[model samples]
Target: MTPSLLEALHWSTMDISGAEYRGKEVPLLVVPTRYLLKLDTTMISYCDMQRVLFEEEKSAYNQAMQQNICDGKIHPLTSIHHTSTYNSLCKLMEYCLSPAVTTLQDRLKENELRLSMLQEEAKQLEADTQNMRNGSPRRLMNHGAGGKSSPTAQSRHPFSNQGSPRSPSGGSRRRAC
Candidate 1:
């Protein structure tokens, strides 16, 4: 029996001495609680009784239930309710989650479309950038006379080549009063 059921039945614990058929001593727990003898017989062993009462394998069941909940096969609170209430809650959850699932699917599709559009825009921008890089030198060369002009021809003062030794005034001049 489950521990809750045992608790509800108000069973008390007592250790009783017993002997095996081979004349060996053994210990037994006497639970002074009314139970259907046939149904309770299977749980009479010490280990089985301890397992049921002390909850040593509690995490196993809890982990299984958690996995079921995550897989959407069972509701988290289903164990706490009767079969009828649990069925009703399951139906209610289905009803509530249906629209939420639909909304999520719609949003996913919208995001995919937006992402594809952005990707296409990025590709176009990359192509434009490549074309700009390829054509820039030719454009710069053509900006002056068909790419034939010397570099100094594009300077702000083409006639004032200042690197020569000749000064602009040809000779030093005295200041006049």
Candidate 2:
């Protein structure tokens, strides 16, 4: 019935090979309503064919699974070493996180070192202040000054006893009581 319908639609015989279809004219059945219905029918048939093929494929797959099980094929769970997409994602996350972790560790270490150096400087400052409070004679020297000394120039100099012109007439002159 379908063949006859197709034949009735159009038929043209040509004496020349590779002839342009423009010169040829066959009786074209331009039933707009019927053509639309036919197109819909073809779509429906194609969908049905796809459905049957898919069902057959599912059944064949199930049979193959049963056969594999009977033949002592590797267990699905044990055979697969990795099926978790999460594991790969976690590995990628870790790979991305490692640099940040290392950077944080380095920054922490550097901060600790800076804190230690600051602590040492604070201790030295405290010791210096304590030394100043204790009235240590060397404190003035540390303060960049000549420490508490006598006003006499003769005693302050080592060459005062050598009788130099810069010394007084006496070898040394002591302050009056």
Candidate 3:
């Protein structure tokens, strides 16, 4: 809802709890809406009315609809079915429903769009994973008993040869104190 909408619809207040016209409860919830549409129609009614089309005047009209009515719930109207009153009310219904319908349609369209995008992304990832698996080698060694490296490679540098038989000291000679 916008202030222009309320202004276009000629709505003075948003609260409608105690609104009455000629002693009858006048449902003002739709008054602002009615006035908005009425303004739109009136502007377009005569060829020389110098009014802009709805789309052109949409911003202003929408602003009017956003007007808030605070605290004042009860209102008394002097007359019912005045030409201005009827037109304003009717416009309210048309404008309110129009945006709602558009919003619902847009949401559904966006949901469908996102669903398609996600599906495509999932398919691409799955294909990439499958390709990597197919290209990689399958054989793998477990690091248990037979598969373990020689102690020389695992513990000391191979070139150092601290325990090699080629050393000057015999392999069984214990070191002297």
Candidate 4:
């Protein structure tokens, strides 16, 4: 039955070159040739297609309008009055902050003045330290001396007591044998 259908459909051939179908050569007969013309069933009329395109365009336009409305709602500062108010608030903030800036500037000036005074004091202390290092004969005196001595005299008489009383024991005495 399927071979008859294939023969009817012109799909079966009589030329069998292989032994597998040697005894099964189809008889040559007048088979009608059929050509299938492609029919586009999904195509609509031109007017209907244009109507669908118009609907899509309309939906896109509506969506854009809705987006613009939403944007306007999200930022209500789209008006000139709101912009002017925002600028005024900024100016007010600057005005409120000016006093703090002035106070900080005054404090900075005072601190600079104090720093200069302290630097002058430090310079004076350094000068005083240098004078003490260079200016006193008594500053170089030895531990037990009462009078100030020059460097040469102190060097020449290194062990002189300069009027300190001697001990009665004379420091230490050895016994005579």
Q: Per-candidate RMSD vs. true structure?
A: 25.9, 30.2, 24.5, 37.1
| lDDT by residue for model 1 (1-177), tens | 998988756643322234335667799888755653542354245335444543434554466556666556687466554445545655665575566567667878999999997786667557546656878854633434343444434353354333324434675653332
Candidate 3 segments exceeding 4 Å error: 1-94, 137-177
TM-score per model over all chains: 0.32, 0.34, 0.26, 0.33
lDDT of 3 by residue, 1-177 (tens): 798987856654544535876766777554555556653345335423222333434554344433322353322231222335445755765575566557657878998999997786667557546655766422211221233434533343443233333324655664543
The residue pairs that clash in candidate 2, if any, are none
Local distance difference test, candidate 1: 0.54
Worst 10 residues of 4 by lDDT: 35-44
Q: Model 2 lDDT vs. the true structure?
A: 0.55
Query: lDDT tens string, model 2, 38-115?
Result: 644665575566556556655755565565574677568533323243345446555755665676678789999999
Worst 10 residues of 2 by lDDT: 144-153
lDDT of 4 by residue, 18-109 (tens): 32744667887765444333223222343355456556655754564455566356344434444465456556655755665576678789
Off by over 4 Å in 4: 1-79, 137-177
- Global fold similarity of model 3 (TM-score): 0.26
Candidate 1 residue pairs that clash = none
Winning model by TM-score:
2
